[model samples]
Target: MENNKNIIPEKSGSKYDLLLKIEDIIKKEYSNTEGIVISKDGEMIYEKYFGESNENQKTHIASVTKSILSILIGIAIDKGFMEDENQKVMDFFKEYDFIDKNEIRDKITIKDLLTMTVPYTFEEYMEPLEDFTRSEDWIRYALESIDGNGEKGKFKYSTMSAHLLSAILTKASGMSAKEFANKYLFKPMDMEEINHNDTKEFSFDTLFGEKIEGWANDPMGISAGGFGLKLSTRDMAKIGELYLNNGEYKGKRIVSEEWIDKTLKENQNGYGYMWYLIYNAPIRMYCALGDGGNMICVIPDLNTVIAMTSSFMMNAKDRIGFVAEYILPALSN
Candidate 1:
């Protein structure tokens, strides 16, 4: 299938010194964590890297790509490529016929997919990653797996399911997801240059090792929605900053403020267009968290944004723990 917090008390010290101590924690404990960037009030407060990683290297962010895709979906609506998230997901999949008419897959809307609440069968949610990734057509396989009866509103997270959003983007925009993202999202934010290649390289052997240009695509050239996005840790913070500033970058508006606001409004599942918006916590924040501790997090109460990247190592220490237990209280006024 597809991939993919607590708070701490206040502490005393210079904010910079406290962050330096946090870096020490990362060095000793979370050895695989590549980098961490923190910005407060649109200013870079701290940025540090560990191991062989540096500011220039772009690491695969796994499910952090889902949050980026959510931004693109909002842009699609903002620019009139699509109307709204309520639009039927089947609107974009007209070319493909349904595998089983008994299922309510067509009734599934874009919001359902965005919130990970699509009523997918247990098998679809738990399908082996190798099996799903090796399929001839990923989007088709995911659609065929949908067996939503009345279970539409319940959370059913799956990577293949999220990839369908990418497919929808391609069909709606007539451009590959990478092309659209590069033109609309990355360029506006002055993101790192994406090295574009159309060649198909779908081997797990090269998945984490190979540094992809721009974003990874399936055989059909559609960008992966749930994973396969590689971005610099600082560039990931730019995304958080963008949302923190209500979807505008620099002086121009990249995405509508309304879309950004709507994207942060959580459903009962605590999800807001692929973002995990935590309203009940002492530090009200939302995060685009991914495997191996990759994340883009926004703390609205503090007017802060944080981004982090780590190697694809199992047993990586928790990014949330670092933020809650040390970073937040360290930065507290």
Candidate 2:
């Protein structure tokens, strides 16, 4: 998108051939793929659209939104909106009376939310999405539904836990996660030009001119940090680029390198914060993996970022392996 044809192609080599092969796999192996975008050293070297999707068309990124929220949490801490990663989450939502408040729940910290290890026993216990729309307070519902008996610091993929992080971001930053992200993360990365409606401060109710800016909110108007964020293939590449540069995008420091460093260390399940780590041979990949095969993979040692979006839901492991199985071996030794 944005007339990116000017991106000079890399030299014709094995890696370039391997880059081209990714599309064939997407088409033959994964028919649901929308597209794949790859960049190296900050320049988009390969991009191809499949089906009806274009380079700029946006779609729901599902759990990939969690990785973006993770970045914003690092920024919130850097800006002092949040005290630190260890801050107790209950401190932010003191207004709510949890149904099963216990020692474990009180010890739930920001880091726990970032790592998906919040001490809650309701793994598959969210009120139905249809029911969420009718509820007056999502955070209250989330807090009340928890059993508070989960093992602390253990990894459990919980969207409600992520929702708590979103609420904390809203309470600490005095704005919705969408507004705070646009102000700090997206706007700085030149999404203003990508969307052309970033001049005015977007109200929490709407952002990017209310024109499908790819954000979903709860009944209480807080952006869902765990899922339902929409971003184009191009926008996803920009986010990977930011992490590739260690929290600095295009020479401007957005979040601290300390935060990036902390994110690289595995917390659980080869996951650091919200980012998942997948080992692909000699390369250790840091990935923002979403339901339905949506992914933004960063190979720090290789200085490469690969992003892909697909229609299938909850199928990311095989897609990630494709990159390792094919792309990683093609690079020169």
Candidate 3:
């Protein structure tokens, strides 16, 4: 069982036995990876953990939270919280633009934020991330950061800019993003309850808690959209499962099939809504990838969902290779 790491096995096959051989390789190679969960044809066939981690432990999941936020955005649309993804960003936050000083901000749509094509004042996405997260009013902070620069449709990615979406969701739903997520997304999917981070200020420890479940928020109580979500390895798989089932969980529709079809299709960039679409892989799939090896991959053709998490590190994108090189080929056989 590879040092007692394999946590669950609902079913198995020759491919699973083959996949098990690579477990030791993954453990020795990706030393920081905390957990891995794989499911095929709707049954969880394998679950494992490493380095003092387990199935219930919630990793920070970093920017993978962006993809989950995208699902919540779809749910918001399905429930009629906002007219559509094409709605203007400024329409929800008149307080941020009372003077109407930024004409470009008025034209920024939710789609621009999802695709990360919205214009920004900073050249590097990290430039404003810390300052934006620490601000007393982050929604307004994110709003003021948008600039015309005449690059609205150009794909300039920013974690801080994505908070605009959480703020928009807050305004549209008349509840905090966490509340909306709990009511519509998490609960419906049977995921563990998610609570707000106690402090308005961000903390790494809150995310690393073995049992403490939390989602971060700005001082204004808007949930962080670009980052700051703590999810268990299996719960992340549940998300992939939800998408693989076309936005239904346990036969109940959570997000529309239309939303699922729209969000999974490759866009102009490699992004599908907030998901990173991968066509070069052994299978055509999409991923919610985060820093240091966190991922939720949905391979529709294979009817597979894979979820994983790791301690904070730099080789985060390597999880994609874990799929392309190992998981998909094993499944194909």
Candidate 4:
């Protein structure tokens, strides 16, 4: 983590006034927001903290973790660790008895997981934490959920389906998802690993009266790919900037430009490989969104990246509005 200094020099007049107004909207209407940082042309331009957080503080980022996982998959492909995204998911888990002799389940591929087209009904995999803990094998449990007999490419967003990608990464690369991220993505970008501080905002109470970092792992110890990642707003911004820079950070290619292009390409439902796209008039954006309003947005036309951390669910539209209504209008062409 970098120093919590306000690196961007404050601009005078209307820009400053508009920033104050944006902060007010975050503090009042968006009751769950912790902080937001906006960067343009790869430099911090506007940043502010609210409630009990600071610029460097890390918190649970909910489903934004999926976007990070997708990045890792990209890196895995770039390094030749995994040859292609079309590799069959069942090929990685041949030992699992659940998929044994099951052709339909075996047909699931890495692209399916990336595109959120896992065959299982969404509700079937919504297993509670207690039940998940008691399950002996998470990979087998996830594989057995291939009940979607309808259209093969139908989009069905499933957190459990995303979680399987983490497990597959571990199997394909011989390292945990966290290890792969640290070595490839985090270390190169100068981001830290899971902050182990017990009192941090992302900690949660356990049945044993102990606290664990916001990261939730499956029974197999693979990090959950869909959600449960804790990252500071600044760290999250680096991710957006990395994509905005087309997979290069500081002249180092973290992921291939081709992968970045495919990720931003419009797919089903205006989504592309876990990234969401929006076209609002003159402003078009690609975003990494998590539950509870956490977002890391990239606006290529303006060359801007925005990251926000929020405390409540169902507040993404409002946060995105701040960008459309306030930030974009202030930017110079």
Candidate 5:
């Protein structure tokens, strides 16, 4: 691939040099890694792909799909498919009879689900698939699977909450979450090489020697909003660029800037919608984090964005700290 020269700064500073070194280190340290670092303005400052980019080489991206789900919700709001964050989730499910008649479920708002505070215990409901054939009816399974716990607005990290958000978006848009994402989010960004892996069967070794199939086999299947997205490293960077640019791309305003701001602003768990806010450092950065260390880190202060994908989901907190400790500080110096 040809490099874009104009995007490269004329006077490369020590930060640039340090980033190069870090890139080299990462390639040597990690196996099957694809990473890119871009300036806030959408310039690729650094890029490296170590393993492969073929069909079977796709990165599962785990929870990073949550960020894409977040954008779809924002688009739904912008298009009037959804009224606002406070809109009742039950309102969107007019045709679905599986939803409980309990007032608590009706009272659960889009905001509650987005923030993972749906006032329900999601753990008992979060069992792995017993077999590939059992992985049908993901939505009903998720809804009925919930173990009633706390009141709405309480803090808890529940995968089922995100699953419900995906279901709501699907109901409102009259399309699956993947379809909506392709039309509204990916297409506008020129991200054509993306795929949603909600339905493929694979197995991984669990801690206790139990063989577990990929979570994609859950009854909710691929539409599980919290995870199950797959994309190229460059495309992932483009997502960060969209958020960094406040929902605009190449003079096109894809989503309202107000929605972008609202999505990044801190909420429960320092989480805005499906995104996370990290204000602990000298700089405030909002990021989309996934399992296996897949991340799109957006540093508004430095006008920078970093996207990383690795085979092993490990040490994301430390990696983010590394950016704060080395990457940005070197850039500023």
Candidate 6:
């Protein structure tokens, strides 16, 4: 809707020529995809959808949901619901007695969860859960399930940490993570297409004849972090735009510029909060990476945001790199 010339590069030949080439790449490189690349100023620069983008076209965004959750954390901080990332997780869940005793667990802070260094092992506990939601005691299960494999600040990538943050947010804000996100993050961004699905009564097909149902409406439930997020490609691009603009959209400051700057900066292992910091040659980029090849990359130096979705197969990082390396150079020149 705004002026797109500032964002999209000037046409060297013709826009149709670029679109045709992109279409060919999508067809050859990715078997099934719904890809869209938007300029930082909010213009649709390129798009290609191999399959139909109807109701059945919904693709699981895997961990890109983590970046959304990170933004929600920013909103919570902005609203004074969260003091800071250093705030203790125990303080939020005061009513829950399950985590009251453990000294190490008490020391776990919101920062620890955001950085994925919560010192917990989710795999040890998750395998046996017949029904995640019906467990009736998610907090106790999570606290007890903690493995304490390493000391705090040691980098470890785990889904359980994100799940823990979800629980802490629910306790602190007095609302479900989805509800909190809807109020603070989604509504502000006008991201109406995004929806959170609880895993209650869900089914997963196994290699054997047995069918698994209701593993845990959201195995992370209040804790179901890391994954369990569904979003459209357009909505994903808006998130990148928000970050690129330093957490401002439509002249309203949704998140503090300070928080956005800190979150986008590289941390231990190129991780900051939930987003991955990529130090690619000319620019230092921040990206949200999901399983099965879903990526939302924001290159601040180039003023570019690339949103992509692929099928169950194909490597997302490689495909996204191709755009960054090959297509972007040609388009910019």
Candidate 6 lDDT (Cα, 0 to 1): 0.65
Give the TM-score (vs. native) of candidate 3: 0.91
Model 5: CA > 4 A from native: 1-11, 28-32, 53-58, 94-101, 122-135, 145-149, 193-222, 314-317
CA RMSD, predictions in order: 5.2, 4.8, 2.6, 4.1, 4.9, 5.6
TM-score of each: 0.91, 0.86, 0.91, 0.87, 0.82, 0.81
**How far does residue 126 in candidate 4 sit from its true spot (Å)?**
7.4
Clashing pairs in 5: 40-303, 138-219, 138-220, 198-222, 292-313
How well is each residue in 1-333 modelled by candidate 6, as lDDT tens digits?
A: 111121234544654355446655666666556655556446666654555553223455667767777877878888898898999887876766763356677788888778777666544334333443345665666666555544667776766567667777777788777778777777888876335445544343210012321112353456245555556677777888888899998787889998897687666578888988886545567789886678888878778887876555544446557666656665565
Question: Tens digits of per-residue lDDT for model 2 on 193-224?
Answer: 22322212233233212233557677667887
TM-score of model 5 (CA atoms)? 0.82
Candidate 5 local lDDT, 1-333, one digit each (tens): 322222344658676677666655554454435555556555676666654443223466767877888888889999999889899876876656854456677677888877777765444345443332244665655555544545767676666677778888877888777778778877888877344444444334321112322224344444657765666677778888888888898778888899888888776478887888887877889888876668889888788888776555455345576677767765676
Candidate 3 residues 1-333, lDDT tens each?
333555345447777677786687786778788888988888877778876787777788888989989988999998898889999887787665355476788898998898888788888445566576566777777777777555778888878656889888888889877888899988888888786555443545443333325877777677878777888899999999999999889999999999988887776678878889897776689999887888999998889999988778754458888788877777888
* Candidate 3 Cα deviation (angstroms), residue 319: 0.8
Off by over 4 Å in 6: 1-19, 54-58, 95-102, 121-138, 193-198, 205-223, 280-282, 314-317
What's the distance in Å from true for residue 260, model 2? 0.7
Total colliding residue pairs, candidate 6:
9
Which portions of model 2 miss their true places by more than 4 Å? 1-10, 99-101, 123-135, 192-213, 312-317
Single out the weakest 10-residue window by summed lDDT for candidate 1: 1-10
The local distance difference test score of model 3 is 0.80
Report lDDT (CA) for all predictions: 0.80, 0.74, 0.80, 0.75, 0.67, 0.65
Off by over 4 Å in 3: 1-14, 98-100, 124-126, 203-213
